[model samples]
Target: MSLDPDFAILLRASADRLFFLLEKFASARVLVIGDLTLDEFLTGQVERISREAPVLILRHETTKQVPGGGANAIYNFAQLGAKVLAVGLLGKDEQGKALRSLLEAAGINTDGVFVDSSRPTVTKTRISGHSRQSVTQQIVRLDRKSDDLPDLDLQVQISQYIKEQINSVDAVVCSDYGDGTLTQPVISAALSASRTIVDAQKHLERYRRGTLFTPNLPEAEFAVGYAITDEPTLTQAGQDLLALTQAQHILITRGEQGMSMFNREGSAFHIPAFNRTKVFDVTGAGDTVVAALTLGLTVGASAWEAAVLGNLAASIVVRRFGTTTTTPEEMRVALQRLLEEG
Candidate 1:
C-alpha cells in the first residue's frame, strides 16, 4: 500500500509545527503503569552440529540485558527527554534490583514501583547465532501473579498516587502486557484521574473514555470478538472496539500491512509501513509506537500526527534485533529524510 496522500500533504504543510511539537518532548511529563520485563539476549556463532540431534550448536560469546515491555515504553520516553514516572510490580530478587537500577539510571522516577513477593520479575531469554538465526531458544518465563483485583488498601494507594500526579503530567500511558499490573482497579483509577493512552496488549475491555487504545491486528480481533481478515472487516473491528472501549481513538498496528486509526467520530486514517530492506526483530515495535504516540500527544500534536510519528518511530526500532527504543535525534533525522524524499 502507498502512503496516504492526504496524510502526506498534512505532513508537508505542518513540518514546522511537527518539529516544534517534537521539541516539546523535552518538557513533557509522562506516567506509565504496566508490566515490567527484562529481555536477555545470548549471541554467538553457529559452527558445529549437536552430537545427539541434528541441531546447530552455538558457541555463546556475549550476553546483553535491556528493559522490555512497559518498562521499555518508559525508557523510550526518557530517551526523548521526557520526565517519566513508572509504576509496576517487581519481585525481591537480583533481576528486580537490576531493573530498578536501570530505570533510575535512565532518569525515570521509580517511586510508584512496588515490591510483590508473590511473583518473580518477568524475564524472556533469546539465543541467536552469528547467522542471527534461532539456533536454540528457551524461555524461563514465570508468571507468579494473581488475577484478583488489587486489595482495597493497594487500590487506595494507587488512586491517591494518580490523583497526586495526574495534574502534573501531560498524559498517562497504560502499557498493559497482561502482567496484571493494569487491573480493573488501576484502570478505574486512570479513567477517573486523567487523559490516558493505552497499549491494549491483550485485555481490551478494560479501556474507558478519555483514552486512546492501540492494539495490533490480533488484539483488535480479540477486542471486537471476531475474525478480521480483510480491510473491510478490519474497519468494522476498529469501529466495534471504539464502541466497546468508548475511547477517543483506536490505532491498530497491522505489521507489514501498516496501521489504521479510528476516531470517536467514526473517521479512520491509514499509514502504510515504510519500506524496509530488512526486518530483524519486531519484538518491541509496538512499545515504540505507543511511546511515540503518548509523547506526540503530550507535545500537542493531532491524533493523525501522533500516529505518523509513531509509525516513523516503529520503522526505526524494528530494523534492530531484540527490544529497543527510539531517540529524539533519530526520529528527527528520519522525518527530515522522509520530507526530503518527498
Candidate 2:
C-alpha cells in the first residue's frame, strides 16, 4: 500500500510519540483476565504417501509448545517490558503446568491463575507440513476444549481475585477466547473495577462498557449481525458496536487492510497495515495489538496513538511463528525503518 503523504507525516510524528511510550512500558502494569490456553505445534517433513489411505506421511521433526489465548496477551505484555499479572483458569494437567512454568520463567505474575481437574487445559495442536519445494503450512489442527463456563465457585474465586488486583494495575486486558474462563461474573469484575481493553472472539456484547474493544472484522460482523463489505458498512458496523458496547473506543482490526477505530461520538480513524510482505504467521497478532494498545493508553497515549503502536506491534509479531511477541527494541527498529521507508 502506498503511504499517503499526509498520513506519512502523521506517522512520523506519531511514531516519535510511540517511541516515547515504548520507554514507559517497563513500568506499566496490566492485568490480563480471560481464558488460558496452550498452543502446541508439531512440524514435520512430508516424506511419502501412506499405504492405508491417499494421505502423505510426515517425518515428525519437532514439537513445540507456547502460551496461547489469554496467556498470549500476558506473554505479549511481558515481552514488551510490562509488569503483567494474569488472572484465569487452567486445567490440572501437564499442559497447564508447562504453560505456568513458561509464564513464571518470563517474569509474569501468575498468582491469579487457577486450576481445575474437571477439564483439560484449553489446547490447540497444529500440525504443519514441510517439503523441499513448498513453504511450511499448517495441514490440520486439533482442539481440546469444552464450551462450558467455569463453575460458580470458580467464577467467584476469579472475580474476587480481579477485584483485589484491579486497583494495583494501570489497566486491565480481557482476552476472551471462549474457553470457559471468562464468565459473566469474572467479566463483570474486570469491567466494573478498571479500564478494560477487550479482545473477544465472540459474544462481544458481554463486554459492554469497556474502555476499548479490538475485534477483528469478522468478530465485529458477528456482533453487529451484518456483513461489512465496504467502507460505509464498516463505518456503520463501528457505530453499531460503539452503541452496543457503550465503549469509549472501538478498534476493528482488519488483517492486511490495517485497523479502523471509532470513538463514543462515532468519529473514526483508520490505519493501514504495515510490513505486509513480511507476514509469516498471524496466530497471536490480536494479543500483540491489545498488549501494545493497553500499555500505550496506560502511558497517556491517545487512542489513535495506541492503535498505531498496536499496528506496529502486530506487524512485528506476524513476521515470526506461532503465538509470539515483540520487544521495545524491535518496535523501535520497526518504527525507524517505517520512517526511513516513508
Candidate 3:
C-alpha cells in the first residue's frame, strides 16, 4: 500500500526543508543519559546435526560488538554529526571497556560514564548460524543485564553530572531500558534541561514535562492498560498520555503502521512509515529516530518536520542488517527515492 495522497503531497512539498534540517545537525550538542549496553553478534557456519541431541553443530565464523540500547542513541547522534556527551553506568569489566572504546572511537564524549564494580556491563549477545554460501540466521540470544540500582552515592554523582552538563548541551536525551540508570533522582536532574527527549521502555509518565518522548504502540498499550483498536481509542490514549506525562509532545511509533504524533494543544499528525521495500532488521531503528528527531528539534525544526526526518532515518536503517545509522546524504537519497516510488 502507498501513503495517503495528502501526506505524499505534504512530504513532497517539504522535502527541501527536511534537507536543510539535516545539514544543520552538525551544530547541535546533545546529552544522552540512560543504560548503556554492548550488542554482540556471534556468527558461525552450520555444520551438521548433533548426534546426542536435536541440535545443529556449527563452526565459528566471526563475532561483532556494536553500541546498543542508549549507547546506540549516542552513536546515532555522533554519526549524524552532532557533538554528543554520554552519561551512564558501566561495569568494571572487559565489556565495559570495549563499549567505551567503541563510543570514543565514534567520537562520543564518555566522561560521564562511571564504573560500578558490583555489576557486569549490560550485553545482548545474538548467536547466528549460517551455511558457507548464505546469509547468517540468528538462532538465539543471551542477555546480561541488571535491574539493581547503582549505589546511591553513584547515582548522586551521575545526577550532579547531569545538572552540570545539561545546560551546556542543546538537548538532553534519556534512553531508559529500565536498567536502573535512570532512577528518580537522575530523571529529575535530566528534567531540569529545557529540551529533554526520552526513549523509555516503561513508566512513560515519569518523563513528565519533557519536550518529547517516543514510545512504540505496545509500550503505549502497556502503559495505559488498554488496547488502541481504533481511531477513537487511539485519540483517547494520546490525550491520556499527554496528561499523564505533561509533555509538550508525544510520538507513538506504530512500527509498520507508521507513527502518530500528539501535542498538548490537541492537534495530531500521522506520518506513514516509508517502508516501501524489504526490511532486513529493525535493530536500533528507534535510536535512529529519536536521534534524528532530537537533533531536528534542536536545530529549530517543527515537530512534524523533525518527525519526518526521524521517519526517513528509520526507513534507511531498517533496510540493512545489524545496528547502524544513516547519514544526511542517505536521508536525502531516501526522500527522493520515496517520492519516485510513491
Please list the C-alpha lDDT of all candidates, in the order they appear: 0.80, 0.89, 0.91
lDDT of 3 at 178: 84
Poorest lDDT segment (10 consecutive residues) of candidate 1: 136-145
lDDT of 1 at 23: 84
Which candidate number maximizes TM-score? 3
Which clashing pairs does model 3 show? none
**Model 2: residue 22 alpha-carbon error in angstroms:** 0.9
State how far residue 92 of model 3 sits from its true place (Å): 0.7
lDDT of 1 at 95: 77
Q: Count the backbone clashes (under 3 Å) in each candidate.
A: 0, 0, 0
The C-alpha stretches of model 1 lying farther than 4 A from their native spots are: 1-7, 44-60, 129-156, 276-278
Candidate 1 TM-score, true structure as reference = 0.88
The TM-score of candidate 3 is 0.96
List RMSD in Å for every model shown: 3.2, 1.8, 1.6
Candidate 3 per-residue C-alpha lDDT over 167-250 given as tens digits, one digit per residue, 9 for 90 to 100: 799999999998889999999999999899989989988888888989888888888889998889888989998988999999
Candidates in order, TM-scores: namely 0.88, 0.94, 0.96
| 270: Cα error in model 1, Å | 1.3
Sort all candidates by lDDT, best to worst.
3, 2, 1
What is the model-wide C-alpha lDDT for candidate 3?
0.91
